[model samples]
Target: MISLTMEKRYEIGLDSYDRLFPNQDTMPKGGFGNLIALPLQKKARSNGNSEFVDGNFNSYEDQWFYLSNLKKVTIEKVEEILSIVEEREKEELNQ
Candidate 1:
């Protein structure tokens, strides 16, 4: 699954495996573009030390670590989406 991310939105292409799933009769008809958007906002905090309260901490090492974890989650999500497409293809092939 080819994936792309822009801002807070993500999209994955599923055109190559179109033959795997049943046609529109069995499934909703749509293009290969599966998109997901996550609008992020800094949560308000009572502690003045909160990252949101102290904007300078945005680039802290801990923040980078958190972002790294988020990157892993994003990768996993893309893989999960591709697995669905692969499963449909396999089912079609078996039929």
Candidate 2:
């Protein structure tokens, strides 16, 4: 998984991946020219758009839509939220 700040997630979620992590095989010969470069994971397309999900949609992992507008990337609670969502899903399915 990519270890990116929450702000990055929002930007990417809004089809801004190309804006941040430009489509390049490797770092520019010299240096990125004021581009918002990021180390993207192999799963992420070199140049692709993100799936637009609604903020209230909780089924999607990473919860990008739900937390996209956050002022700060509160990564500290990612696992906690995931765990809680998982537990809720399991309980609902078992009922």
Candidate 3:
């Protein structure tokens, strides 16, 4: 399995919902608006062939390119973003 770390940054604003639920809900429960990064590993499979093949080589490159498209984020950065969102939510709730 290929393991990779991700880093994310975010800017959040307070709104009506934030006012309803502040520190009680520091995070979005679930929705497309939530950002998520998942680590995955892919195994190369051959078509009934024990020997290495050209197709296998190509598959590795394809996987690399696909993963490269995803943004790399650090754990600290994610925490920072989450904190910002939570703070905004708290402020909204106070107002």
Candidate 4:
């Protein structure tokens, strides 16, 4: 799934990753610029920290079922969203 939040994170990182880590040439080396620990870690899940929740913030009873049903977002859709975001940002800067 190509979530808006996830894509926005990628967009922001593309713009700011190097400035945030001047000493490290991570992006140039094909790195994502940072390491994010895998979600749903056993310990974190047990503590109610890493579980996916619903819009109402209720934990789903069948996380695996929910995950299995998610449809994949296409690359075209992602590029479209990125272009919209870029245009919006430009408008904001001009305001």
Best by TM-score: 4
Residues 5-75, candidate 2, lDDT per residue (tens digit)?
Answer: 43556544445344434444355576743243222232232343333245684244454554565576467
Clash number by candidate, in order: 0, 0, 4, 0
For all candidates in order, the CA lDDT equals 0.44, 0.50, 0.45, 0.66
lDDT for model 4: 0.66
lDDT of 3 at 78: 98
Off by over 4 Å in 2: 1-20, 24-70
CA displacement after TM-score superposition, residue 26 of candidate 2 (Å): 15
lDDT at position 53, candidate 3: 26
Off by over 4 Å in 3: 1-67
Q: Which stretches of candidate 1 lie over 4 Å from their true place?
A: 1-73
Q: After superposition, how far is residue 36 of candidate 1 from its true place, in Å?
A: 19
In angstroms, how far off is 36's CA in candidate 2? Answer: 10
Maximum-lDDT candidate: 4
Candidate scoring better on lDDT of 3 and 4: 4
- Give the least accurate 10-residue stretch of model 3, judged by summed lDDT: 1-10
lDDT of 4 by residue, 5-91 (tens): 447666544444344334343344655343333244566678887777899999888877887788999999999999999999999
Residue lDDT tens for model 1, 1-95: 12222223444335534553233223236542222111122332223333321256543435435545543458888999999999999999999
Model 3, residue 94: C-alpha shift (Å) = 0.5
